[model samples]
Target: GVDQLETYFGAYLPQFFYAMLAPLTLFVYVCTINVTSAVILLICVPLIPVSIAAVQTWAKKLLSKYWDQYTALGDTFLENLQGLTTLKIYQADEYKNSQMNEESEKFRKITMKVLTMQLNSISIMDFVAYGGAALGLIVSVLQFRSGHIDMAGCLLIILLSADFFIPMRQLGSFFHIAMNGMAASDKIFHFLDMKESEKGNQEFPDNHNISFRNVQFAYEAQRPILKNINVECPMGSFTAIVGESGCGKSTFAGILTKKNENFGGSITIGGVRLSDISEKSLMENVTYISHQSYMFKGTIRDNLRMSDPDAADDKMWEVLRSVKLDGYIKEQGGLDMKLNEQASNLSGGQRQRLALARALMRDNSVYIFDEATSNIDVESEDDIMAEVHNLARTKTVILISHRLANVVKADNIYVFSDGYVAECGKHEALLEKNGIYASLWNTQCEMENI
Candidate 1:
């Protein structure tokens, strides 16, 4: 898109004026010398655009297909590259390679079709331009022989005949590029014209209590993910949402953050409707951290500053100490120490701890930890949860975890099954009920014992 836009603005637009005016100026000059030849050249100049118009009907479809195949090839390559290790581990690399090769071949075939169409159009334009010039030259010779014009006039006509067609020929060339630019512009305009999500004018309410009443959500009409779900995560409480995978646990958190806004019921923050709160105000009061929280390739200080841009060095150290990462950072050359992409230079536990520390820098009223402690060492998980529990002392903390052990201390644990809340209460109460939560807890306990 950038390349096409640059070519359209930088080269095509300027050349467009020259192509239109240069031919007219030269045609008038030829007319002054030989009217017959000038008229013939003018007649032939239109054939160039006529041929372009003809090619355009076919070129538009071809270019669109070319772009589609190009995008598909790129996506396939990236997906394969990201999953290369897994493919090799499973001995499926050969199958993936074959799939990628098929996609590449399709792209190559479409690319050749685009080039062949361009060549054929250029050939037609060349034939019209030179044929018209040749015809004009013959007319000039015939006029000279009849003594209707002088030899000098005939030579001038011959010399300038090609000039008449040159501008139009250059235009024919630019027409193909213009077609490509227009194709890209079509996609860009479609995206730009799409309706944006509605914005609310209401400010964030002072009360941070959250309540979901009869919420229902589905990606498709036939497949519901959350059905008439009602839950509460009041301020100054620790609320945990736990369920088996595919039971809409994450979708519950997603609704509060406005990730999925097309729900049937009302979600309110304090007393204000969630949709009524402006996005800026909602974000200012809520912090969501997940297991795969992204870590940029920068210094430790640089990453922390994302949460609180003006946080001082002392404050950074304080948060790091809260996550028990301060000693590790100091040992690794302090906050200025550089991290590799995705913080791959650090161990998995270190990365999570650092992420938690960065999140701690923010003074948001609500903190949502969506499986934030997953895939980490027990020590790191315990340390992170300790800080999370501490935060629950005065803030609304919602924890979503797959591990049944993690939410045992939560003041309120909502157990989801299928879509609705199957069970919700303190850990001991949930276990005593012998329902979904109890079943999940017993299963995990049995696995741990094994």
Candidate 2:
């Protein structure tokens, strides 16, 4: 260790030593003239830590602000990417870009402020370290003339005093870097301190019969998305939820799946209120496929394996065939064909099919399709809807769709509007009522040229 240290010093110290020839010459002049260097040593010692401490204090403040800005930037980026389609449809790309630039500029300004503070602190520290030492040496030399110290002692003190400041001053500057690290730690600790979702009662009956009794829920405080949503999805029966936009269709599905647990009233699965049931057990019986189908970045087979890791390749092929994606996959190099992030490399219909295949692999007792056919092409939509219709025969399916025609064959349909169930019946029965469901259905059918 000693040899290594000396070797490192030998490599870099000479360059620093050469750069300080003027100061070294001054020291040589003072010492040779029988001057003392005690005052120089004293000034260098205290100023090292004090100046560093000041810089460190400022660094802590700056880095804390930086972490906040970084987190905000990440959140904005995610939101922008998720809403990219809407932005493009509305031609608001420039608007979002400007917003992003605004946050970026704020980040840049904070970064510059930190850099400026560091530079100013370092400049002041360097002056205190070098200038004060120089002045102290001048005073010590004058004192030596008054017989305070001998020539040899003066030479040693002059040489050693400058050398002493080198390490202490550098170490002092490191205090600022340490403070920045501490500031980052503050954010990490805050995240760590946040309360995790609660673990509830674990007992669940083998049979999965979902029932919602006066279930009330809201994402925001006291503003209910779902208001007294009383419904029952009996075992071995399909239940379709028909609703217009913002009618709490998705919210109801979310509650049934136990994705969002903060709700009023009771939701029971197999006689066990979901709030009392453990998250793991609830997930085991329920599988939800939403409107925006997400695909993991891997081969098609790899993504299929996510739902059932022990599933054989042939089983996956069978499931793919069931969703009518097998022919396409086979033509496009089979399951070995890689899916990019969110399946961006594939068409919208293809991604939807892949998501369906994954869900089918789970083969859970309950299936929730929240506008699952929204993105597919007409031909693909027909094929996928057919597959969904078939799945509903055996599994307790909750189909939430705006396309009324798809739910025509459903055993029961509950129409929702303004966060309430405005109408409830089979598709034909609801159509006969000529209410909101009838209007929406007529409008959608006209648009589809059906």
Candidate 3:
């Protein structure tokens, strides 16, 4: 969008001035030779803009649709390209290829329509400009024949009649370029006009206890994800939220990180409203680590430093050692080893350990481990959980996971079912009740034994 606007302004401004000033100058010259010829030229110049305006009315809708399709096609292509390996694994490459081809065809049709509109508009402007010039020359010849103007004056009018319409005709050509920029600007303006989420200026309180009271959330109005969720993670407590898939375990934790703010009820941190806390203070106080934590394309030291930019080499190694990743880093060329995109070169366990190491480097008051141990080997998972337990001794740790075993040591376990908290207690207490939590735990135990 920026590129289109730049191209339009950079090239259109000079042409716009020429179109406005040059045609008036020529009109004055023509009037000196013959008033009637000057009047005819003046009248015809406006017809070019009339045709351009007519084209613009339709081109606006066409170009807007063209940009929409262009953006959609680009998004689809990038998504498919990034997931190409997964597609090939599932033998779905041909399907995705055909889907992309359909998107490309739609883009091609819109582009051709834009071109056709440009061509038709230009043709109309050409007819108005040249036909008007021809009309002026005809009048000049008539005045010459009637002896109202001399032969020199008539010949000059004939030569310069076309010049009168040339500037306006060129402007008609630039109108199409400007139209594209205008369409892009409309989208940008619409985005800028959207209402921002309200935030308060209060700083995070020193006491880090977190609580949710009757909190409810939904991505859509009808389908609620978290309903009447009331949980608490007091300072220096190991609070775990365990649930089956789609049971809102992650959604419960997501509220603390401000992933989604549109919810019912209220959440408070140290008796201060969650919404009252400023974004900077909230971010500085919380660290969220998920199973698929993003790793940038940089050295191991570089990725770790994102959590603590000024962290020294000794501190980095200490954090890495805590996650049992120090030996792996030392063998793989130390902290300076370059990681590929998403750190694809590292195994799943190694990546999670590295992510854990990075999180440990930050001195946050609250830590959220959202399925952080999933898909990793037993050894790496144990090492990561050990660090998490250690962190819980000081920081307020909220663990969200579907795995029943990992939450066995939690100070309090909140088991979510559907969108509500169905059970809440310690691991043994919930199991003794023989409720949803016990059912899930027993099923998992049976699966592992099998």
Q: For each predicted model, how many residue pairs clash, with residues at least 3 apart or on different chains? A: 0, 0, 0
Q: What lDDT score belongs to each candidate, Candidate 1 first?
A: 0.90, 0.77, 0.90
lDDT of 1 at 42: 86
TM-score of 1: 0.96
**CA deviation > 4 Å runs, candidate 2:** 1-48, 55-57, 67-105, 135-143, 201-204, 432-434
Cα lDDT of model 2 by residue, 1-450, tens digit: 122334334533453444345344555654554434643544355665677667767677787897689778889999999999999999999999999999999989988888888788878878877876576656656666777776665555556556645655565455445555567667667899989767776866677788888888889985778888778778877788987788899888877776777788888888876877887877887889986977989899899999998999899999999988898899879889888888899898888888999999998888899999996798878888999989988988989998888999988888877777778888789889999889988898898785
Candidate with more favorable, higher lDDT: 2 or 3: 3
lDDT of 1 by residue, 1-450 (tens): 446777777777787688778878888888888788788888888898789889999999899888888889999999999999999999999999999999999998998999999999999999999999999899999999999889999999989888888877877877777888888887888899999778887888888788999999998999999999999888889999999999998988888898987899989988899999999888888999999999999999999999999999999999999999999899989999999999999988999999999888998899999999999999999999999999988888999999988888899999999998999999999889998988998899999899
What digit string (tens of lDDT, one per residue) describes model 3 on residues 1-450? 557787678767777788878879988987887888888888788887778778889999999999999999999999999899999999999999999999999999999999998888888889988898899889999999999899999999988888888888878877888889989999999999999889879999999789899999998999999989899889999999988899988887778888887899989999999999998999888999999999999999999999999999999999999988889889989999999999999999999999989988888998999999998898988888888888888888999988878888899999899999999999999989999999999899999899
**lDDT of residue 7 for candidate 2:** 34
Score residue 1 of candidate 3 by CA lDDT: 55
TM-score for each predicted model, relative to the true structure? 0.96, 0.79, 0.96
